[model samples]
Target: MTDEAALNALREAARLSPENLPLRRHLADQLLASGNLSQAETEYQAALGLSPGDHGIAIGLAEALVRQGKNEAALTALDPLLAMPEHPVRAGVLAAQAMLPVNRMAAAHWYRYSVARDPSQADPELAHRLGIGQPSAPPPSSTSPSPIPSGPAGLPAQPPSPAPAAPTQQPSPAPAQQPSLIPTAHSPSVVPAPHAQPQAAGGPYGSADVEPTAEVEHSPVTFADVAGMDTVKEALRMKLLLPTQQPELFAAYGKRAGGGVLLYGPPGAGKTHLARAAAGELGAAFVNVGLADILDMWTGSSERNLRATFAMARRNRPCVLFFDEVDALAARRSDMRQAHSRQIVNQFLAELDGVDEHANEGVLVLAATNAPWYIDAAFRRPGRFDQMVFVPPPDTVARAAMLSLMCRDKPQAKMDFDKVARATEGFVGADLKGLVDRAVEAKLHESIRAGRPIPLATGDLMTAAKTMRPTAVREWLGTARNYVLHANESGAWDELLPWLRDLR
Candidate 1:
């Protein structure tokens, strides 16, 4: 087949398997080669989203952007990769090319620095434009001085070219003979990528091929920042926070600080926010892994992503690794028709168990799902999501607190939050926010008609809440009741019984 036909076939395949990162990247590479800059950019972005922080893919994306005369965009793409401690050589070259139009000196610095590292990529036009070397001059030999400056501050003074040696007789000086420039004003200092960490040798989840897309951050939100759920907060303090705070005391009783806690509730009920608060309370690194971060269309890649995610959390000790919508990743294997899907579930179980050399001594695993009943039974086993924490919808007091906070910034009259909270019974945090938004929107419309700004009041919120029902609560409670009634063998979900009874 012709090259065009092969490219078309690959394009169709990529379209069919949109989540296939390698295939998307290969197609992007082909598109770049074929000079389809726009299409290539799109595919590269998709692939980058799948396997974030891949240097090769980032460089390819920047190159494609630069070729399309989107120099600003290309520089944006390269900035993060260039900041990484270990980046590909091409990243520097592409960055130099992108920077040339805006800043010649910076471009020259990057070009010379890159070429100094590996001379084969030397470009005459770029070198000449940056005033580094003559366009007509022969490529530098190993013995020649590097065009890069001696230090970070200024350009190097060129010495006269050395006399040519015979084709194969001269001894070459090592590249290290030249002084390595410190990070310049344009190039930032060497820093490890957010997901980059040292891997343990031959460990099950220690492969460097996959870098977790989930960011490890020190959450600043404590229980004080969280609005309510006093019962849930107390439970978390005992189950997670207190143990970490008094590790020695807990250890004496044969209890370790780290374990898994599953937070299941209706969507937008502040499950994620609570997890972050737990991390903040412990002063731990929070790694929030979403469904998109783990699922991959390619075989084995999903498992690798999952392993790498757990590996990352392990490396960052005292980490609260919270997986949101985890039901998709750890669903019942018996119900899955695809072997790959079951493999992902199995991989998740193994990671939780910390199989082989991997240990979860200091890692606190937390997962949130709206449909916890869908997760595998094995996940509920001891040491792996053994604690089922039910996050119920906001109570009246919690709703009042939330309403007061949500309205703090808005122009308002003397608002009775309790009145509004009482009217919107069973509303979750997100539903309350939406009610506030609708009220503000109505106020805006009324203000326009009256030609004056109108302030929000208790009545405005109550009026808005009248039209909106507790949409997610009913559906979620319906499902939870069935599980609690029939599948509560281990009684992990016994706490949900009260909420389920309220549904009656």
Candidate 2:
């Protein structure tokens, strides 16, 4: 493709996904390479907004300013990055080079400093112009009569050329270096281009090709997309949704922005769907994790993976980290027969507690489990899994809603939703969907038989519901009942108690 075409394509992509830091940075790099200094500066500034602490992008912006002959502006742009310890040699080199056109003396100081940090990258050609040689020990005191070597002509050999017209303002040296703990900044709204999830030998989730970056997976589902379960919806609105929308009100009473909300119920009860809806409603990024994302076959790796996942989650602040079947990972330590399993539980607690260096500061952790009884009791402490919301089978209202939604596009007559909903009591969202499919199948067969069309009616749906066997809720409730009775401490199972009593 032509350069113009590539530039246009990148610009369009950056426009479409304005929060995409990597895409914007890549576009900025391309523009700078093409000598489009002004546009490159704008793109770099944008990328910097998305990732304020990114030194590489900061240096890139400085370079663009330097290319435009704004040496003083370049120095200001490079200030924050230069202040960072393990001082980036690239930033220093760029700072030195950006100053070369006007402030040769200041440029010489930075040049010497850059070469001290990275001998390989210092531009030899530029160093030659400043009357400097390769990096060596400290030079003699400035009081010496002859600071630099003189040629046979009694003058410095190859006298440095004068810089172009200097701007009114003088350039200052790079800022003093300070320590920075900036991690890789990846915008949670941006889905990285498809690539392998490379792993390393010693590090947790690492490889030469991969840097420790944030993980953000998007979900299109919102509360409107969720089929039914108004009870569950209102519970979420009160627990997760309201606080996020009005954080200041909650903070007035010492409440933090995000916390853990446990969604537990029978299998296929739309627990995962509820989590996705919460993410969508918040307009926050979503990351759905499973055993495959954390568990490793090797020893001591599981805990590291847990730490790494939490770290990644925190980086994608305001992120919803949904864990399906979380009981398998956070199972009661007393019940765990193996030491490794127990250790993993401890690691989870540490992450939840914001131990040592890591914390779930802005991350909203949502874990769903069929066996909430299996999760370690420690996980239910104040800050972690504080609110447990039971996602029961679809009620009459939910059943009717699910049926109407499923059949909205199909040829359905004025249907008696109440009749079908009453018939399919104890059914979950998945089961309700199956009933609709069965009804559609019947309509399809009748159409084929008569060689004409037949719209779905209430009789068609009720017949399909009757044909279906006992709902899966029966199987799940049988197991859950035993827990609510035997382990009723802390009233964690109090909500389940009422439901169990109703079933009886």
Candidate 3:
């Protein structure tokens, strides 16, 4: 093919398959070369979405941000590169940092260090502007210095006369009190200072002197406080509580190592509540690992945080590491673009594998993701999060239970919960709770308007329902059904499949 035709074909490939990182990167480079900054920025962002830590994509995005007068944002993007010990784009990153007004001190230090490391990088004009330049050594003094004499004590007692020091110079009133030749404790020395030596009984980094803050122990939320979800409660008892309480029986039955469980469904479906209840039932220490908590601006910090989280869980045996919004951190590896994300996923996988069934004892991993489809396939294997539980929206029975729990303390004039349940076909636990709250609020509003005591009635709830829409719709349910079906067929979560199907 001709060069022009090949270029056209490459562009077509990129446009047709934007999800492909390599193709996107190539097209982005081509667009940039052609001065199509807008298109190039989009392509770069697409590439980044696939591989978050791509240096080329990161640099491209940073440059785009700078061109848009978002210099601070550009610098923010380069912060991760700075944290990396040997980032390839160090020069470009330093240049970006130098451009930011708030990072002057750090930028100046980096520029000086970089120039010292490689003089070729030094730019006289830029150095002059930044008030940085090659440092000059001090010149030697012309006057001759006197030598010290050793005493019988073996210590330097007095300065030896420099052959009478040319009598003429000394004639000027022999300095009143000769300065001592001995150095003070604070003086610089070839040897390390006494205080500089490492101390025992201290933290390795010398942080022992600083007292740590008192740790606030987390209290697990119990099922009693969770207003409703009888079906969910029962499921937890049979599937989780029974297994945990009678491990000997489970082991004898050859079901001791079924792996972890994943609770996935629409948001606010009581997934977290069910997970907490399971933790309480198992009497396990609850560890909530949120994506926001693990993500850091520095490269490798995310992976480090992941390791630390697992280590903490291992240390606190019989613990439940509840990863909330798990998809944000554990999305499909095929969709991952950044090295940092890959490292984090790999560390997570390793830790998951390291959890010994016998050693872990009561320890369990409960991850909940609203977007289950986004979860990495590797994580869904038989030995990992093999039990994928679909915590679907409450059925009529669950809705009735929720309604009764919500309006128990309120004044309801013989409300038919069955009718209300039928009305809320697609409602999740949270949606039901919200409906009750809104009804109560509306009743209160009406009472205040009429200058009377709040008298909540069935009519008020019906009115609230008209204003409130169920959060989960047909499309969400369809997506969830597909995921559940896929998991069932793959035998990835056969242990939990029967219960999951019953929920559907």
Q: Which candidate leads the pack in lDDT?
A: 1
RMSD of candidates 1 onward, in order: 14.2, 22.9, 16.5
> What Cα-based lDDT does every candidate model obtain?
0.75, 0.71, 0.60
Better of 2 and 3 by TM-score: 3
TM-score to true structure, per model: 0.57, 0.57, 0.59
Which regions of candidate 2 fall more than 4 Å away from where they truly are?
1-215, 355-358, 449-453, 502-504
In model 3, where do residues sit more than 4 Å from their true spots?
1-120, 123-240, 253-259, 355-359, 446-455, 478-504
Candidate 2 residue-wise lDDT, 1-504, digit = tens: 999899999999999999988899999999999989999999999998998888889889988987788766776677555544345777777776766666565556556656655677778887898778766423222121212222222212222222232375333222221111111121111111232233343222222223333457777888987876777777667655677788889779876566788899998788998899888877878888877666543224456667778777777777888889998888887774444556678888888888633266568889999889888889989888888889988788888887887788998788999889999888888888888898888899999998988889999999999898656788788888888888787777888776777665
Q: Model 1: clashing residue pairs?
A: none
* lDDT by residue (tens digit), candidate 1, 275-358: 999899989899988766776532355678888899898889888999988887787877754445566788899998887533
Backbone Cα, N, C clashes tallied per candidate = 0, 2, 7
Worst 10 residues of 1 by lDDT: 174-183
**What's the true lDDT of residue 398 in model 3?**
72
**Sequence-dependent TM-score of model 3:** 0.59
